[model samples]
Target: MKLKVCGLTKMDQIQELISLNTNFLGFIFYEKSPRFVLNHLSLEGISAINHQGKVGVFVNETIEKIAEISEKSNLNFIQLHGDEDENFIKDLRKNVKKEVKLIKVFRVGETFNFQFSIFNSLVDYFLFDTDSKAFGGTGKTFDWQILNEIEIPIPYFLSGGISLENIKNLQNFVKVNMRENKTLTKLNTPFALDINSKFEIEPGSKDLEKIKTFKSLLK
Candidate 1:
């Protein structure tokens, strides 16, 4: 499994994660978010980071704004963590560069239908996170067992309240899920683990030692 360290606000932290070879680096664009990247780093500052996995997370933001930021920040991927439906995604897809990938987030509660054919063609990946009134960064876990019941067609990132204590459990769960998915060629398993609040010392500030330990254990 891959690791995605999210809610970054510091250049040193970003460089540290890059040195650790973290798979994805997430930057929140939503002004309401406590870890909103613009508050700490300018668009040019974000773009200056030498990494390919930089992901810009937005919440119901306008297509033009997202495209502009993505371009300015040199973001390779875009994560929509809001109520963006298929039509909106279709329009955004057309507006952005063709190489830029899209990750549509699903804020899962205790139980969800797990039937999301509407976005099958619109997005490149699906990110499952605990439902939050605050739009994620809740540091809470939804029942991941809920995913075992269905077949996901594309790769996904599992987020929400993932910490050092439960990281092993999550690894075992993914192993089992992969084994079961082998028979179905079209089925997909989690491609990455997204960590945020649990590894933070404060909003937007990450604890490097905790993240380093987690990475060692994950290996």
Candidate 2:
């Protein structure tokens, strides 16, 4: 599986992940988040990074602001992680460059109903994260069994509480779920694993050794 390392703040660590070929590097735009990228790096600073998979994570942010940030930071992808409705997304898509990919996030809690029809046409990808009052980065995992019940059409990123302890079992989990949910054959398995807080030594500070070890195991 591809790996998306989220909540990045340090410049050196960001370069390290790029050198490691991490598929996606997430930077939080929400001012409320402890891992908010602006707290450590400026938009110009982020734009200077020579990586193509830079992702900007926003929560209930205005379309104008998202577009402005994307432009200034030169983001390759945008992740909507809040109660953004269809109209919000449609308008945002129109305002942003067509080459920039859109990822709509769905928080999975006790139960989840995957409405592929509602978002399939609107976004390039979907991200399923554990439900939390904090928007994301709760360091809690939802029931992976819930994915088997949904009708997933596009590729998705599985997030929340994914750590070294659980990384090895992820492949098995996907295989078993695929077998049990026969309809899943029509859809691809998770395109990537979105990891954040679990790999961090502190908020916004990732443990480089842990990430290296995890990547080695995946190989």
- On TM-score, the candidate that comes out on top is 1
User: lDDT of each structure?
Assistant: 0.90, 0.90
Tens-place lDDT digits, model 2, residues 1-219:
899999999999999999999999999999999999999999999999999999999999999999999999999999999999888999999999999999999999899865656988899999999998778788888987778766788889999798988875777777886676567444547889899998999999999999999899877
Predicted candidate 2: what Cα RMSD to the true structure? Answer: 1.6
Worst 10 residues of 1 by lDDT: 180-189
lDDT of 1: 0.90
Task: Locate the minimum summed-lDDT window of 10 residues in model 2.
Answer: 180-189
> How high a TM-score does candidate 2 get?
0.95
lDDT for 148 in candidate 2 is 72
List, residue by residue over 1-219, the lDDT tens digit for candidate 1: 888999999998899889989999999999998999999999999998899899999999999999999999999999999999999999999999999999999988978775587898899999999997778678988888778876778889999999998987887887878787686544556789899999989999999999999999888
> How does each model score on TM-score?
0.96, 0.95
